[model samples]
Target: MRRIKKTQIAEMLLEHQLITKEQLETAIAQQKTSDKKIGQILVDLGYVEENKFLELLARQLEIPFVDLKSYTLQPDLVKLLPEFYARHFRAIVLKREGDAYLIGMADPQNLLAYDEFERILKAKINTALIREDDLLTILDAMYRRSEEISHFAESLSAELKPSDIDIFSGTQDFSSDDMPVVNLLRSIFEDAVQINASDIHIEPGEKVLRIRLRVDGVLQEQIVEEKAITQALVQRVKLMSGLNIAEKRLPQDGRFSIKVKDKFLDVRVSTMPIQYGESVVMRLLDQSADILRLNQIGMPKEIFEYYSQLLTASYGLLLIVGPTGSGKTTTLYASLNELNKAEDKIITVEDPVEYRLPRINQVQVHSQIGLTFANVLRSVLRQDPDIIMIGELRDQETMEIALRSAMTGHLVLATLHTNDTISSMTRLLDMGAEGYLVASVLRAVIAQRLVRRICMKCITDATLSPPEITWLKSLKHNEYLNVNYKHGTGCTYCHRTGYLGRIGVYELLPMVPELADALRQQDSNKFQLLAEKQPLYRPLVLAGMDLATRGITTVQEIIRMSGEI
Candidate 1:
């Protein structure tokens, strides 16, 4: 393909009328003072759309234009060019033709890069024009050292054979520093940390062992062909967690801490006997990760303000209600972090203390020794505490004591396993707490669920389907029908899933006189009606939909999260 000269780029744009002459003059003036390329300057200065200009340039240069958003490239081929060359030239290795390699470059006019690549790689080069942003996405995603994980897995498969099985002995000690099982496990942990995964699953199958990582609330699997290696891997994990390696008949739970790639991770392990073999799951919590402040979490403005006000109260019960893995504990911790002060004494009683706060006192629940939540909380009340945080409302006794503590002038924050704010009232009533007590000291309820955020690297315009429009209309959300929405096209950056991380969706319900009256009367229907009538009250579905309208999440995610709402 013929190359377009860099000097003629502006002239061609002028001939094609893609940019006004005044705009070109402005970009030229800015180009003199900045190190940026003229094409990038034009795009940055709003003189031309990036993809449109790149497509036209490709046509003029007689090169193919490729969209790498949903494109899959071989990892081996991508590694041919060093990371330094990939970033310096803004290029990616696409594929190999018989004697030449096809290279995608944002600036195909840079003939110097072509010459250097051909000289170093000893092959002819073919050029394809790609968007600069897409090039950046590919560069960051491709260099995550995923091939090293695959190589480690392959080595483990080759090293361990069927004769290595020793399930009866329940122990296979490896004194060698070059053990493949150890290397594979370490590589898997490093990869999981790099990808921000929450859980790792190692399962034994009839033919192979499957390894899966839970990222952004979804599971991504990797298969290991060696079934004999499962026993060794399980033993290693058991040993690290300080569990009995011989007792594989019953389920067991244990925890351990490790440093992977300079990040401290707390792993919770659970083992179960399955049909094939033992299924092991590891939940990873980054101990070194910064705790999110109240404002940093994704709370809407009005709700955040109201909840902040509740935290300032001298004494009341503030409950965070959600199911498992809905981020209830995170919200509770953030609130405590907001209220942590020298003048106020704060204490928490958790079954297993997940995080350690600097000034706040934390108690762990140990039922075997009679140190349950209720027992510990009853004792903590006599210590002249100003603020109290309970990890969970596990029983009726604990529920009643927490309410009494709130009524007796102590700010108590706790979490409940309920669907929404209103159901929490019913739960307390069902737990045998007096309705009057529940009504007197209850300040607010914060219900939350986590939804995956779209990958910003590959976000694009999206149109709502007919069914989605109908659903929104049924909810009286007609304002969203014409709004411009966005979604992510599958990309390597998000593992081809179009979502990178998770964000919280909140439903804040503050107590009012009318709602309290309904609660006291044990009338849940009346309480819900009055709560929904409040100006600041929005259900979980509405909150999630608002995020979808702003392109923070997708409509499908809102629907998926609102199954109970």
Candidate 2:
């Protein structure tokens, strides 16, 4: 393969109009003071897309462009290059042909890197271009945490005492000392954050203590063999969360903030007394991340416009319904972010305020002290609030207050635990809400579910089986059968699971006069029929199928998310 200088690459990009002359000059100026190369500076300054720039460079240099995320290296070959040298050179072994080794590099122009690799391997070398991001991601995955975690576990097992004495007692304070128990806990948390896991489970068995992380809505077990350190690990977590470390007979809950490397997270800790011991579950919430805007929440263009109209309405009740962990809170927060303005006064009453919004008054529900959602909402009404957000409609009193407030000219946005959009109406009515009042104030209902997205790095075309195609035809979804579909084949970037992240599938139901009349009449059959007739009323199953056809997800994900064929 041929190599080009940095100036030649920049000039080529400019000649193709990939970036403007002004952008090239700005990048050149920054390259003088920074250690990053001109191409790296241009990409960092958002002058061009990373993949596009890399593809252009590959074409210019006449070398293959390797996507390291999809490419897997043999364990033996990976051992040939030490991790220190590999990371320092930003390179990896791609393949071996006869006596020559093909290496993937982010910066193929680095002669020093080539010299160092040749000296270490003592073999003929070939070079290809790879994306910087892809190289870094593959590096982290190749060098996993199994070795470090096992080392921590071994150290803790050796240091632990047989007696049930609390090593982290007397004040819940932290020290800079290198305690094995503390190091084990820190590794667990850091791994969870690195994988974007939502929850961590620590369960003690009769012979072993198991650690599991919930990633992409599925639990993956970790490698921890030492059961002797269970108590010490539990005590350390309890101290950090401010829970009673001595009490193990009942359930308790607490929260704490942790900094894993540079990322800050808020972890909600809950403990329950199991037969073996106390089982702990921690829910990790990102505290340092910015709030997602409405447009960024993955809503379809038409639905987003419709939802925006509902938000702008002066007075009505808009309900977002879903099961637990269905991204209800995220959608609500995104909606609130769009409506957060100086002209409107917004107040939210939550059981435990999750994220703190600026310039918005938030209240936490304390039912033990008689300060419940109903009480807080009533107080909010008297304060003349323009918008009120209730975390969840738990009881009849809260639902009644929310209905009255919506009828009295205040835009009310709240969440409910229901399986679908149409069911939310009956859930409210079953909670003792009057039918006529509900029909008068209800504006719209949004039902949502989170489904795993296909890993783009390893995506390939997929064909549905006979049974799968028959099921889709039965549901009147014929358009999907002839379309080109895709799925991930599993790779290191996705933990060899064929999926990397999640996207929301949604269905919206707007309250028209015809449907409202059926709702007021308490006619379930007529209401169901009318709901099916509404243009905006698509079932969650069909919505998910749309995503599947578009290659954003897979057929299995649509079925798994809907729990139906």
Best by TM-score: 1
The per-model lDDT (C-alpha) reads 0.86, 0.85
lDDT of 1 at 103: 94
Query: Which clashing pairs does model 2 show?
Result: none
Clashes of each: 0, 0
The TM-score measured for candidate 2 stands at 0.77
Clashes of 2: 0
The lowest-lDDT stretch of 10 consecutive residues in candidate 1 is 166-175
User: In model 2, what is the error at residue 246, expressed in angstroms?
Assistant: 1.3
Candidate 2 C-alpha lDDT tens digits along 66-96: 8766665565576588888888888888889
Off by over 4 Å in 2: 1-68, 71-139, 165-178
Over 307-394, each residue of candidate 1 has an lDDT whose tens digit, in order, gives 9999999999999999988999889889988999999999999967888889999998989899999999989998889999999999
RMSD over all Cα atoms, model 2: 7.4
